[model samples]
Structure formats: structure tokens, C-alpha cells
Target chain A: MLLPSRFSRMLEVVSAMIMDLLGIPPQVLFGQLLIGLINGAFYALLSLGLAVIFGMMNVINFTHGAQYMLGAFVTWMLLAYLGIGYWAALVLAPIVVGLFGIVIERTMLKRLYHLDHLYGLLLTFGIALIVEGMFRYWYGVSGQRYAIPAELTGGYLLSFMFLPTYRAWVLVVSIVVCFGTWYAIERTRLGAYLRAATENPTLVRAFGINVPLMITLTYGFGVALAGIAGVLAAPIYQLTPLMGQNLIIVVFAVVVIGGMGSILGAIITGYALGLLEGLTKVFYPEAANIVIFVVMAVVLLIRPAGLFGREK
Target chain B: MPDAAGSATATAPAPAPGPRPVALAVQDLNAYYGDSHVLHGVDFSVHEGEVVTLLGRNGVGKTTTLRSIMGIVPRRAGSVRFQGDELIRLPSDHIARRGIAYCPEERGIFASLNVLENLLLPPVVRPGGMSLEQIYQLFPHLAERRRTQGTRLSGGEQQMLAIGRILRTGARFLLLDEPTEGLAPVIIDMIGKSIRTLKGLGFTMLLVEQNFRFAQTVADRHVVMEDGRVVDTIDNADLDRRMEDIKAYLGV
Candidate 1:
């Protein structure tokens, strides 16, 4: 009887500290986690594109944020100017951005292949700045709002919290896309050619594969992934000229933590770091923004190659 | 410069009765590595259904000759004719499409792919290449470790996989560079037996070798090189009589 009373007293003290001192209920914590997962969906998508591009071309592709912003702008322009719907924009936006990426590869990026990687990075960074400047000039800093589709406008009431239908759809679709890409690159016959080319392009060429063409298509595919992420993000986030700027930095951090040029690493670390950031927000709100960077530093110190990456 | 030794040997057939058509002919081929020249006026020829070995001391352009033939070298001039088609201007992929497969000295096996994936990685440029079953039958060790990563394979198994991969590409003309470079004695014997088996299957091959004994076991002729020049061509039948000459040329 004395032991039971003492245990109850300890539990009561802990509960009081959690409720009164912390001021965040379990429901609120769970809600932030769901929101984090939603953000993570986009991170996984964007970083996966970066990893694929880096894996194949050995180019850092600093223009990825601009490409993501282009995806969102294309979706908005299609709906506003051409009266196209969200469903069509989802498919069309990526294709348009992917083609643009192809042009960039063929005209500018190909010339820098023989040079050091820093040149490619500088060139792409400049391109990103120019593209962002043009968009900002066209459309001012204030963001345009995009309404959610009719089919996914409402919220679903759960026992713990209210979940938006669009956010839930984002989580599901991004996970599917991420895993689908992993399967394609890891399990398919074409994937074998890509993997072989990645290892030794000269040998693959001697085997009669057009490795340059494969590189172009890979860059296009990676850019298209960013476009898809942008379209998925459109309904939730505002359509702004500077929208992709801040997000891209975090995505880069995710890539660095995951390991450069590691596809599965990008996807896994993206989602995991997003969740970690959410937990940080619950416990220490001021450190939420820097939690991912701290994790990145720790991971770098522990394993420079990353959790899933192999050393080159 | 014409290959005078090669021309003289063509008149007297040692292995076969009649003269088979030339499958590959290199004429005055000169290649450079940036400002450094590697091959200068190197000349040789391999007849159809024949296994020819390019024998030389280290850095005498044996590997460069093979790479130049495959169009892998950065700057190579002069003519490389394969089956009446001039390959001097063609890119490596186009040359491969025209039926010349190269197994490099380093044995370029993709570590990312499994053994089976590595075996099946090269696209079939022609219809007459070996099927999967035939390749598996040829290299039983490969079939056993089909799911193992390419680099995880032993040296002998990797060599077999490299040769088997080219066989599946339908390229009857193979340029094998040092296939027996770093293998155990038993594995080298197996490779020699496989080369003989492939010869019986009517494959034409040009090989580069540092091991003269290994080359003598599989080759129909040995073309000796000195400083990127083909100085002599000796038939395999005359190999025993010319062993001292070869040792001098190879500086062994």
C-alpha cells in the first residue's frame, strides 16, 4: 500500500511538470509531428533529386531551388493564365521544368564537365540568382495564395488532432514517389545500365552505351522530381518568387547529413530529420530551426560518409 | 609503315591450311596521352578465327594499342580497319556496335551491380551473342554467386565475368588485355581453357600480354613490339624456336 502511494505520487509530479511547466499537450506534440512529416515529404523529394543528379553527373546542381520555384510558378501560371486544373499541372509542371533542365545541361553544364566541380557549382549558383531575380522582378515579394482542390479541401478529425486532407495526401504521395524512384534506380534493367555508367562511364561506352545521352536524361529526371515536389507543395505553401530560397538550404543540409550522391540516404535522412526538428520544437522551441544543422554536425563528426553512404 | 613481318607470315599458314580473311588490321597507328606520345607507327593484323597476342615489355604500347583499337584513347591517329570498316574515325560506342568488344586490363566490373547484373549489363549489339543460359553454362561460378556484388567476386571469377559479359554482346572480335594478369595458376589454366573453347566457337581475338608463356598457350601468333613499333611477328608453331628472341624483345 505504501509503494503504490509513492508510485502514484511520482507519476503525478511528472504529469504536472509535463502539463504545467512544458505547456505542450501530447495532442499538440502529435500535431506538430504530422506537420513535420508533411514538410519531410517535400525534403525527401527535393534531396532525392539532388542525390540522383550528383550521383550521375558529379555536378552539385545549385539551381535546384530555382527549379523547384519554377515548378510552383509553372503550376500557378498554368492555372491562372490557361485555366488548367491542379491535376494537369501536377503532370505538366515537371515535364516543362525537366525540359528546361535538359537545355541547361546541353548548353552550359556540358562545357564545365572537364573543369573542376567548383566551376559547375559557381555557374549553377549564378543561374539560380539570375532566375530568382527575374521572377522577383516579374512578381513582387508578396506571395500568391493557391486554394486546395475541391476534393481535398476539408480536414479529417482524428482522436488526437485535426489533419488536413491535403497534408495527408502529401505524406502518402511523397512516400510512394520516393520509394518508387528507389525501386526504379535499384531494381530495374535500365537501372543496371545507370549504375554501371555511374561506376565507369568509359567502360560503359566501350560496351556501346550512349553514356552522354543517359546523363542528359538523368539530369532531366532529377529536375522533374523537383518539379513534382513543387507542385505538391503549391496547394499548401504560397506561390512566391523567393519561396524555394530558404527551403533549398534546409534540403541541402538534409543531403549533406544523408551523404552526397546517396539516393536512399537522402530519402531516409530527409524524413527522419524532419521528425527530429518537430520533436525539438516541442521540447525546446528556440532550437527547432538549428536542430537539423546540429544533427548534421554530429553525424559528420561520427561518420563523415553518413548513415547509409559508403565512402568513395 | 606496312607490317613486313605480318605480311610475310600471312603467306605461310601455320595453324590453318588456307589464309582466313583479316578481321582487324592496324596501320601506322599513333596515339598520344596529352603531350606524351604512347603509340607511334604501331602495326599488326589478326586473321578471322585467330587469337593474336601483342607481346612487349611494360610500357611498350601494348595496352595503348588495345585502347586505340577500341577508340578509348584521347588522341589516336592512323587507320584501324575491322572487317573492311575503317574504325579510325568512329567513337568507341560505334566501334562496339560494329562488333568489337574490349575487355580492359583493369577488368572494369561495376561494384554497384550484382554478379548477374554485371554479366547482363552490356547491351547486345548484334543478335548472335550468347544467351543467358549459355553464359551461365560457361561460367558456373558466376551462376552460383549471381547475387553477389561485382567487386566481391574473386579475381578469377571477375575475369570470367568480364569475358562472359563481352561474349553476350554479340561482338565476335574481342580485344582482351591481360585477362590473365593477376590470377592464381589454376585460374590462369581455366582462363586458357576458356580461351581455347572460345576459339573453337569461332571467335576472333586480339590479346595484349606481359606473360609470354600464358600467351603461347592460347595464341595462334605473337607480334612482338618495341617502343610502340611492331618489330617481329612469329607464328605459335615457331614459338619454341624463337623463345630466346622473344625473351630479348621483352627484356625478360
Candidate 2:
């Protein structure tokens, strides 16, 4: 009996190796692709926020990751402590984070407005450390799992793959959020003012636009977008302190590849890069992790300002 | 030349019967840039529909005066009044909404945005100021480059776009700094024509120019500034007689 069990274990190992050598099953491959698409959605949202803040205000916003983590934590706390549902948390989290951004802008960012862009990056980095440290003190480094809402607990079966309802919802929500922001800044009247102010604040103010107020609002809106992405991510990933920290580097890579020319570029680059990463995982598992950075390096070498970047 | 003088006199219509309104006045204005007092007790004014020019050599605080009036520079102590309304304490946008517009030395155009986009920008503030057709009529070259990016335009085209942008804001008072600073002679002539056209439309102007020829052609009165202080005010009628003093003061 012991010999037969050992043989069965060896057979199991050999089958796994064979499966690795051969192409992954279509079902498993598509499953990984779907996961990659979801990740792409998050990357698109986060990078779009970064682009907006950096393009208009010339602020790098290092605290964006901390704000994203705070969004998840806020949503988790709302559900666990206050008995708020997922829908309510989704609406409330962004408002809370946006208000927090307003405070930061008024108190700290206002002081650094006249300084160089590097100072804004450093100050925000410090703020990130302070916020993360405080959250770690309260919640500790261990992660907590958030329950999937009752409405999104099931899955739908496709031809070869099963798509979870919650995952599908994440994709839809992120797309809406991303496109909505792009339209607001690209196609509207207010967008013209924001772009003009970004180019020249003094001249914009002379046109009767309160540019300082616009700056504050733009920063707040960008931060709020990150918060919304965080809430969407809470159910998929383990709710932890370091969740946003790991993701932000990849989003930055996305921004560098896209070159903050227009909002559409950021979104498209993010999603396409994500899909490419998914394909990489299928063909060569080991290179999957570094694929985005590799793409970024190539983009830098080809077009330093990025695909849509303007030459100075 | 009576037609020219008559047109110039007709350019500055008298203030309507009211409570002796001061159209645009700056009194005892002081400004600083990181402890260097650039504007020291500067004083000046412009009446309704008057074409006033601010003349000074480089670094004599001519641009600073325009900035202070537009609230771009930090004012330490001064009052900027327009039609008896206090403008010093208000923010730049509020001051602009009160009908003051500024064109800086750099010709701040949204380089990435196209010419039409730049023209469409200020109209959001005053939707009825001027239509695209009107802007096209004012600067035909801008009409030709309507879809071209602002950065792609030549210097003359950029100046036209800058002036056209402000005009679209429905601003009656224009503070233009060195509009003809660096341009081809033909471009200068084009700009001069536009200025004359704008003057015909009865717009008030506070122009800063280094080109005395351009000023002589456009200005109704000239205020000479030296080291942030108004040295003299000369009407266009006395301009030829004071050429010696003007040359002595300006070193031109």
C-alpha cells in the first residue's frame, strides 16, 4: 500500500511537469488572462490618477499609495464596524479620501506651490510614511480578508473559463470611472480651463478663472480616483497595509510608458500592457513579473517622453 | 492729418456724467520679489477709452507695474481702482471678472492646445465677446492656423493668438506688455493694424512698449517710469517737443 501511494505521488509530479512543458490548458490560460485583465483595470485607474495630478499640478503625489490603502481600510472599517454595505462604502470611501486630499492640499501642498516639483514629491513621500506608519500601528501588518458582497458571490461560465461576477463588476466599474474622468477633462468646457491653467496659471487667472481653487479641486479629484480603485480592489486582494505600495510602482511604470499626453493614452497603455503581461505568463512564467518594466524601458529608449509625450 | 487727430481724439470718449469715476488708478503701490522692492510707491491712472503707454528701459519695473495691477505680483501697499471699484485686495480672477485682462511678456499660450482651442478657451468666461469668425477676421493668419498647435506657430502668430484670446474675454481694458518686443517688421505692421482696429472698437489699453515709433503711432498719452516711479506724463501733442527730454531720460 505504501509503495502504491508513493508511485501515485510521483505520477502526480510528472503530470504537473508535463503540463508546464506543454501549453497550459485553454481553461487555465484564459483564467490567468482574466486575472491579468482585472489587474490591468486597477493599473489603468491608478496611472490615470497619477497622470492627471502630475500633468496639471506638476506634483508627483507620492502619498497616492497611502491614500489608496486608506481607501480600502476605510471601506473595510465601514463594513465591519458601522455595518455599511459594499455599495455605501464605494460611494463614501472616495468622498472621505477626496476630503482628506483637500486638507493636504490646503495645508501642506499650498506651502509647496511656489517651490520646485521635487519638493512636492519629497513632502508627499514623507506624508506617505507618516500615514502608513500610523495605519500599521493601529491595524498591524497582517492582512484581513474582506467578504464578497452577496450580490457578487457567484460566477458565470464561458466556453472554457469561468468568470466570477465580482471580477466582472470590477472591470466594468474601473472602465466607467476611467472613461468618465477622461471625458470630464477632455471633452467639457471646464476641461479647457484646467488645461489652460496647467499651461499657464497667471494667464488663466487673468481670464477670470480662480486657478488656485481649480488646482486644489484637480488634486482632490485625482486622489479620489485612486480611492475608488482601492475600494474595488478590497474584495479581490487581501486587505493589507502594503497593498497599494506594491501596485504603485507598476502604475508608475505604466505612466512612463504612456507619457502623460492625454487621459486616453494612460488608460489604453495600462490595459494593453496588462494583457501583454498575461500572455507573457502563459509562454514564460518566470518573466511575467518583470514584463511591465521591460516594456517601460523599451518605450523610454524609443520615445523618451512616452508614446504621447510632447518634446520640450 | 485732422482725420488722424480727430480719430485719436474720438478714440478717448469722455466719461459719462456720473460721480467723477476713476476708470483705472494705481496709487502708492509697492511690490517686492523675495525682499527686493521692485515697485516703490508707483502711481498712475487711465481714463475711459484712453490709449496709455508705459515706457521704460529694460529692468525699470514696467512689466512689474503691469503684474502688480493684475495682482500677479504681491502688493505690499497700494490701491488699484477701476471705475471706483477697489481691485487691489481681490484675487486675480475676481479682478479679471471686473473687466481687466493681461497679456504677459512670455505670450502664455497653451502650447499643446491648437489655435482654435486657445481662442475657444477665454470665451467660456465671456461667451458673447467674439466669435471664431471675428477672431479670424482680426488675424487672418490665425484663421489659417486654426487647427495648428500653439507651439507650432511662429512668434507673430502666437502674439496674435494671445491678443485674440484676451479680446474673446470681453475685457474692455487690456494690459499688453511688450507686444512688439521681438517680431519681423511686417508682423509688427500686422499687430499695429490689429491695435488700430481694436482702438476703433473703443477698447481701453495700457500698453508697454520699447518701440517709440509704435508708441508714437498708437499712444494718446505716455507715462514714463524710471526705477518704479512715474517720471513724467506727456500727451501725444507734446511728444515731438519733448523728444530731447525723452531721449535723455530713455537713453534712446
Candidate 3:
């Protein structure tokens, strides 16, 4: 301890300061960790959809944020307008948005495949603007409260923290859905076709598979995933029309860190980064906003292809 | 210039006997890459059970001619008739459904997929393709590494898998682009033997090869392409007489 260099001594002092700040009472630490995990679940779910859609069609899906907002909006409309509860809206909202996604692909996105990648990104950006604009005009950018379903209304008192039953349900269901999607795309025969089509649609099509239709369906599925996440998020967050606006940039960073087109990477990185974000809030609240971007820069410096992206 | 190898083929039976039916027929096939014309009025045909080779130098539209048949490369104007049906208007997959299989130059193997998955992926185009057992028997090395990812196979093994993938499609007509390319001599010999086996099993092939020697061994007929058009057609029996023409066009 007496023989350390000046730089090493400085590093130790800084870490010691960090450790002291990070050392929290169990209640606060556990609660924050759970919050981070919940955020990570949303991140993984959103980024997984982005990766899937990007893999098949090479589209960046700028409308993902809009789709997420639409999920909450759809859920709200179902509950307020039609008196539909959260349980049924959870199942229906995503399907509606997914069908909208299919229509977008068939009418707009399909025409852009032969052109530059920027065209697709720009078109989706425009669509997102239109969707969010329409919602803002009517809803006035205010937060809408979604009542948690009766089944998931209570909180669980764990030894370390008070875990809201709905938040726990969201975490568990998101993990299940994310893994289910990964399994469908990685393990099943249909997944094999999807992966192959992503690599070489021409070759896959040559084998009598309807690759174009599959691409449309894949876009639909990705949008549906975004919608599902939105539905889950409605109860936890104040359901603002602008909720997805800021969250998307963070989700995009998560996708970049995880590696675009790498499913397992996306899932793992999403949760891990969310947990890190949570820890940052407890240890260094001042650096919380830009923490993911800093990690992204470091990861990029080491591996330009991304954490799991294959360098082409 | 007629080598000693020509004698064995000369003495053997014609590659396709008794009123050979045309499996594919291309007429005035014109293709373009954007504004640049690639194939200019190219015409060729492969008969039932015949192994036809399209020989040309690099960048001389040899590969384009094969892609034109598969409809992978759109033709500016021409007719591609497969099994008495017009193929020029059909989509690429529709063309494949007509019992024509294409093996692209890159082998087009999915690196993410295993050998068995790759082999089983392509839908059988017709009913005459080699069975999985037959494919395993033909390339035991493939069977040995069935669970290995497609691109993980040795170049020769991948080539065999590429060829074997289409054979399982039951497609009687196979478009193979440079089957001997970048392969070791031993692999070339094995590939030549495999082509002979396919020929024996009545597979019709349209091969595009810069490897003239490999072409001579498997091709029942040679169609020499220049720039884009069919410049010369040398039946196996007549190649010796046309050696000067082949040499001049292909620079072989």
C-alpha cells in the first residue's frame, strides 16, 4: 500500500469514494436494482424488435417509437372508449399495431428495398413524426393513467424491497416473450428460414419460399413487439404521448451495444445495461443520463462491429 | 491438339441417346447490369441427360448467362423456356419451381445454418432428386459433419454441400457456376467424378467454368461464349477439330 504509484493511488481513492457512495442500505439498493431490471426488460424487448426487423429487411424502423406510443394509446383507447380492461387490451393492442406494420411494409417499405438504406430510415422517421403528431394534437401531450388489472394490482413484500406485483409481472412476462421470440427465430425451422432469408433472400426464395411475404410478416412481428412493450409500460410509467420519444434513443444505444442482428446479444446487453443504468443512479446520479452512451463509445473503441455483431 | 483423353470419350456412347429432349432452351437472351449490357443475344440449350458447359474468360458474361436462366439477373429481352414453359416472365423462385436449380458462384451457404439444415432447406423441385441417404452416401464427409455450420466445412465439402443441396430439390436441371474454382487438385478430381456420377444418374447440367480441363472431363457438349453471345458449340466428338476455335475464343 505504501509502494503504489501516484496514478494508482489516485485510482484507488476514486474507487474508494465510488464504493462508499455505492454502498447503500438494502431497501434502497434492492428497489433501485429492481427498477433498473424493469427498465432493462423494456430495453431488451424494444431492441429485440429492432434487431429482428433490421435482420430481415435492413430497415432501421424509425417508427418503433411511434409504434410503442401507439401501443399505449391503443390500450388507453380500449380501456377508456370501449371499457376494455388491461388484460384484453394487452392481447389486442399489439395485434392492431402489428397489422399496421404489415400495411406499412406492403405499401411503403416494400418499394424502398432496392434503393439506399437511408430512404427506409427516412420514411420510417416521417411515419413516426406523423403518428406522434396526430397523438399530440388530440391528447395534448398529457399523461394518461392505466389502471393495473385486478389480478396484478398488489405489491409483494420481499426481504430486501417492496416489489410491485405488476412490475414483477412485467419483468417476468417480458423475459418470457423475449426468450420465446429468440427461440422461434433461432431454434425452430421457421427461424432457420428467417435467419437464412436475412442472409440471402434470393437463395431462400429460389427454394420456393415466399421471402417477400416473410419479410412483411417479420416487420409486422417487430412492430408487434414494440407494441407489447408499450402495453406493459403503460401501468408503470405516466402514459404520456411523448413517453417513447426519449426512450427510443436509449433503446437504440442498447441495440448498438448489443449488436444489431444478434438476438442473444441484444437480450443480454439490454438487461445488463439496464442494471448498470440503475446502479449509476444510486452511485453517480449526475452521470445517469449519458452512462449508456459512454459504455457504447468504449465498446465501439474495442469492437467496431458491436459487442456481438460479426465484423463484415 | 486432340489429347489422349479424347479417345476414351470418342469410344463411349453419346452422353444422351435416342431423341434427346431439350431441358432448357434460351433464345436471343439479352441481359443488363443497370445500363451496361452484359449478355447480347446469347442462345444455348441443354438436352435431357446432357452436361453442357458454357466456357468463357472472366467478365465475358459466362456467369450472367447462368443467372439469366435462373431469372436472378433480369433479362432485358429474350426467351428462357424450361420444360416447354416460358420462364422469362416468371419470378426467380417460380423458375426454380419448374425443376431448375441454381448453384451460385459464392455457394450461397447460410453460415448460421448447419449442413443438415442447409441440405433440407431447399424444397424438392421435382420427384427425382437424390434422397438424404443418397446425399450422405455421395458425400460421406458431409454426413460426418452434418451438425457443423455450413461455412465451417472445408471448401471442397462446402462445394459438395452446395451441389448436394440442389440435388435434393429433385431438380433435374442444375446450373453450376465454376464447381472446380479455388479448389485443390484432389478436390477437382473428386468433383469431376461426382459430375460423372450425376451424369450417370441422368442429371442435366449447365456448367459455367473457366477451368477448361475440368469442363472437358464432364461436359457432353461445350458452348464457347464470347463477350455475351454463343460463339461456338463443340459436341464432345467434335472438340478435337474445334480446339483451335476453343483456344482462340476462351484463350484456354
The single-chain TM-score for chain B of candidate 3 is 0.92
* Cα misplacement distance, residue A184 of candidate 1 (Å): 0.5
Question: What's model 2's TM-score?
Answer: 0.87
lDDT scores for all predictions?
A: 0.89, 0.83, 0.87
Best by lDDT: 1
Clashing pairs in 3: B129-B170
- Those runs of model 3 whose alpha carbons end farther than 4 Å from true positions after fitting are A1-23, B1-17
* TM-score, predicted candidate 1 vs. hidden true structure: 0.93
> Which DockQ values do the candidates obtain, in the order shown?
0.76, 0.45, 0.57
lDDT per residue, candidate 3, B113-183, as tens digits?
Answer: 99998998888777867788787766778999999999999999999999998888878888999999999
Report the first chain's TM-score for all candidates. Answer: 0.92, 0.91, 0.92
Write one digit per residue (lDDT tens) for candidate 2, span B153-252.
Answer: 9999999998888887778889999999899999998787778767766678999987877887778789998998888999877999999988876888
Interface C-alpha root-mean-square deviation, candidates in order: 0.5, 1.6, 1.1
Which candidate, 1 or 2, would have the higher TM-score against the true structure? Answer: 1
The order by descending lDDT is 1, 3, 2
lDDT of 1 by residue, A1-312 (tens): 123666657755665566677787756777889878888899999999999999998999899999999999999999999999899999999999999999999999999988999999999999999999999999998987777889988877654467888998889889999999999999999989988888899999999999999999999999999999989988888789888998999999999999998999999999998898888878888999999989889989998988777886
After superposition, candidate 1 runs with Cα above 4 Å error:
A1-23, B1-16
Error of 3 at A270 (Å): 0.9
- The parts of candidate 2 lying over 4 Å away from their true place are A1-22, A260-262, A297-304, B1-21, B123-128, B131-133
